[model samples]
Target: MLRYILHKLALIVPTVIGITIASFAFIRLLPGDPILAMAGQHGITPERYEILKEQYGFNQPVWVQYFDYVWGVLQGDFGISVATKRPVLTEFLTLFPATVELALVAMIIAVAMGIPAGIFAAVKRGSWFDQLTMGVALTGYSMPIFWWGLLLIIFFSGYLGWTPVSGRIALNFFLKPITGFMTIDSLLYGNWPAFVSALRYLILPSIALATIPLAVIARQTRSAMLEVLGEEYVRTARAKGLSPRRVVGLHAFRNALIPVVTTIGLQIGTLMAGAILTETIFSWPGIGKWMIDSISKRDYVVVQSGLLLIALIVMAVNLIVDVLYAVINPRIRVQ
Candidate 1:
């Protein structure tokens, strides 16, 4: 297991390098000069533009710039955000916790709802409950996240006033961001009102972000569970007078998790992608919103570095999921 994990970790360096190269090329290919964009409404004189280019090494050869960029990244410098004039890494770190919190809550909703719906569906098979759930799952899978988020806002926030329309929490409280994650920070400070505020703010966005992933997880789980439930061991356990719950939950669900786990892992990328739309709709302060703002401003450093960091995070999640296979089944570890 350790050897396998080490091997996966070793592979990440090359993968990250490839991602960086691709992202750098892509960001450059994007039309508009980041320097000029950063100049804003006041704009810049051509003479000033040349000096700014020289300062940022835009005057250097592409190869030299790439090497220098890589070197800076290795030293933990992601360059300064042209828009904000803050270190790109610092800007990312400050905003990342919100994204993490949103994604985590969304995943929890997906897993908590999806797995059981799948298990029940698999158990019930062709029943009305199964049919209805699968129908809803299909709707969820096909629904546009942004549109869905808007509908939710219209109903829950606009009409009912049950939830906040946008933002992480009510701005008036001014909770000091210890962890940057509002829910955790609220709990740590023992501020239940703030905690409730944070949670209320989270629900719409979390549900909006969760929909597609929940559908995917449910469908994957059902498919995996169906296959596992038909296996000889499962039949043997049933014939041996094992309780149906134990046979299904303990044996079938455990065995079925391999594919389900892979699906869940793949959904990390989905969640991040969906976050862009979800954050925009909800005005959630997260990497997605930040990246969009950076892109419109043509802040090359933030765009490139943010893409690389998100890619790295996805790869790390995939690696972690791969490792879990051995733990889940034990047969893979033996092999």
Candidate 2:
């Protein structure tokens, strides 16, 4: 297991290097000049432009700049944002919790609903419940996140007036951002109203962000469950006169979870991607929105570093999921 883990950790080195190259190249390829964007309304003169470029190390050879950036990253420096003039790592850490909160809530909703829906759908097979669940999953998977968020806002926020159109909480509530997660911070401060408000604010955006992941999880869970249910051990358990619930829940579900876990792990990347659209639509103050703003401002350092950080997070989650496979099925560890 230690060797396996070390191998996985070693793999991340190349992945990180690839990410750095891609992010660096991709941001530079974008049309707008970062120095020009920084100049804003009153643009700089030719000498000023060259001076600014030199100051930011843009005047260096491309290979030299790349090596410098990589070295800085190794030293835990992601560079100062061209737009904010703040360290990119500091800015990202500040906004990361918000994105994490959003993603966590979405994952919670997906798992809570998706696993059971998939299990029952698989168990029932051709029944009405199964048909309806599959139908809904298909629809959810097909729906575009931005359009879905709008429709939700129009109906829930505009017509029904049940939820706010945007933002993390009502302006009336003031809870200090202790952990940066509004809901947790609200509870820590013993602010019940604030907690409730945070939850209400979370509903639309979480649902929007969770849509694709939930659909994917549900479908994957059903497929995994179906495959597990047909195994000889499942039939053996059933033949022993075990109750349907125990047989399915204990014997089938546990085995089914290996693949479902992989699917869920893969969805972290999707959730981050969807959060970009979802955050923009709802004006949620998360890393996704921060990245979009940085992109607009041509903040090359912020964009590149932010993309690298997000990729790192997804890779880490996948690593954890890989470790879990051994725990979930010892046969994997033995192999």
* TM-score of structure candidate 1: 0.97
1-335: candidate 2 lDDT, tens digit per residue: 88878888999999999999999999989998999999999989999999989989999999998999999999999999988889999999999999999999999999999999999999999999999999999999999999999999999999999999999999999876789999999999999999999999999999999988898999999999999999999999999999999999999999889999999999999999999999999999999999999999999999999999999999999999999997887787667
Q: Per-prediction RMSD in angstroms?
A: 1.3, 1.1
Off by over 4 Å in 1: none
Clashes (backbone N, CA, C under 3 Å), per candidate, total 0, 0
lDDT of 1 by residue, 132-218 (tens): 989999999999998999999999999999999999988877788999999999999999999999999999999999999999999
* Per-prediction TM-score: 0.97, 0.98
In lDDT terms, which candidate is top?
Answer: 2
Q: Which residue runs of candidate 2 sit more than 4 Å off their true CA positions?
A: none
- Candidate 1 residue-pair clash tally: 0
lDDT of 2 at 315: 97
